[model samples]
Target: MDEAARRHNEKMKRIKAARDRMMQDKTEEKGLIIVHTGAGKGKSSSGFGMIMRCIAHRMPCAVVQFIKGTWQTGERQLLEEKFADECRFFVSGEGFTWETQDRDRDIAAARHGWELAKAQIRDPAIRFVLLDEINIALRYDYLDIEEVVDVLLTEKPPMTHVCLTGRNAKQELIEAADLVTEMSLIKHPFRDGIKAQQGVEF
Candidate 1:
């Protein structure tokens, strides 16, 4: 074969081998919990990416958005229009902590949202559950840490992937999470007195 053809055949072979390996590791109803945390942005964006990937594979997902209640983003718009039936998105009525400043109200809303969020854990239909901004609620003690941990540990279905995102994740949640990512903020437009843009920060 010519040089280009030889390289193409080699690439095909590698792809086939990788596909076989993935098939070998595939299982029915197994689930994973992913936690994305830190003092940086993009936590919800990362979760949204995973949701999109799951939707691409025809898998169901549920999202509980905390703190980020009012602002609308492109992901929300797309999910609303395109994947309306594939995923569930709930926005908490209580806004950010600094804005609300009502501990009782925040805690109450967190508890109410947890009722819905926990259902996704045991739901075999939902392949992925994204708990957006959960870490922030946990950090602020808006939700009961032990109760949340218990539900996560005991209720998740097999083959399900859970994604949690927010800043300042508790050490206990990190210990329980299968995959944890800490996003560090090197710079942001907020530092330069640029207010949160509609598409970017929302």
Candidate 2:
């Protein structure tokens, strides 16, 4: 064998051995509070990906979309249509604040979505809950972050995984989360006057 190929094989063996050792004792399993946030795109997309994972595992899921407010999304369509037996979906927001142009209605919509989210978290039959765009609701002060965090941390069923997605996640929520992912925006097509494509962006 060539010297370079031999060295690469040895390096991969070492990496695999180290990874096996690190994973050996990770036996503890509990539902996780996962947060997806930051200025970049794919926050809700990531959360929906998790829902797909849960569906693959035959785990029941519930989704409450807070700010998109009934806007049609490909993920929403597929989950609701193909996986109707596996998931319950609710759209709470009328739309973004700027689009709706009504603070009272925005707040009401957020609160309504939050209530649906809480019900999902409390349902023992539901294995996963995604509060899509809830961070945006919190950012706009449409919902109380403290109360949201408290209920999420204390009241969710023991085996119910919960995911919150949006930009500007609350510090308290981040502190309480088991996993937090921040999507950093390096470049987006929209910056160059490209419109959002349906399959890619929605």
Candidate 3:
């Protein structure tokens, strides 16, 4: 081999050895509480990606949308059609908080969504549960954070993973989660007066 190629192979060998050692230490597998939160977009999109992963594995999954219920989404339609036997979907919000503009109504909707989520969390058959936009509901004080955390910590099935997605996830919830991903916004097209498109934003 050329000198450059030999050096490259040596570097990759060390990297592979380190990765193997790390993998050897990760011997346990169980349900994870995953949180996707930040000011940037794609939180719900990432949650849906997990649902797709569960569907690929033929594992039962459920989704409880706490906000953004103004219209049907492409992901919702596709998942319902393709994974009908493995997925349960619910949309409890009337619309965004600004659209609804009713605190009492928003609270009721959030509670309803939480009820659906709790049911899915407790179901052993459901290996994955996505609480879409739940962080926003919690941020608006529409749902009790303590109550949600209690159910996530105590009531969820041992082998069932749960994902909560939205902006402004509470510190308490972040602390309780096993994995957390925050999408930071450096730039977005919406700032340039661009409107949300059909498939891209929805």
Once fitted onto the true fold, the runs of candidate 2 whose alpha carbons sit more than 4 angstroms away are none
lDDT of 1: 0.84
Error of 1 at 70 (Å): 2.2
- When summed lDDT is taken over every stretch of 10 residues in candidate 3, the lowest stretch is 75-84
Better of 1 and 3 by lDDT: 3
Best by the lDDT measure: 3
Q: For residue 119, what is the lDDT in candidate 3?
A: 85
Q: Which digits, one per residue and each the tens of the lDDT, describe model 2 over residues 1-202?
A: 8999999999999999999999999988898999999999889888888899999999999999987755788988998889989989999987777898889989889998988888889899999999999999999889998999888889988778999999999998999999999999999998899998998889
lDDT of each residue in 1-202, candidate 3, tens digit only: 9999999999999999999999999999889999999988889888888898888898999999989888889988887788778899899998889998899999999999988888889988889999999998999888989999999999988888999999999999999999999999989998899998988877
TM-score of each: 0.83, 0.97, 0.97
Off by over 4 Å in 1: 1-30
Expressed as tens digits, the lDDT of each residue in 1-202 for candidate 1 is: 9999999999999999999999986664447778898888888888998999999999989888887776676787788888889998887746787787788888888877788898877788988999888888888887888888888888787678989899888989989888899999999988899997776776
List the candidates ranked by TM-score, beginning with the highest.
3, 2, 1
Q: How accurate locally, in lDDT, is each candidate?
A: 0.84, 0.90, 0.91
Cα miss at 97, model 1 (Å)?
Answer: 1.7
Which regions of candidate 3 are displaced past 4 Å?
none
- What is the alpha-carbon lDDT for the whole of candidate 3? 0.91
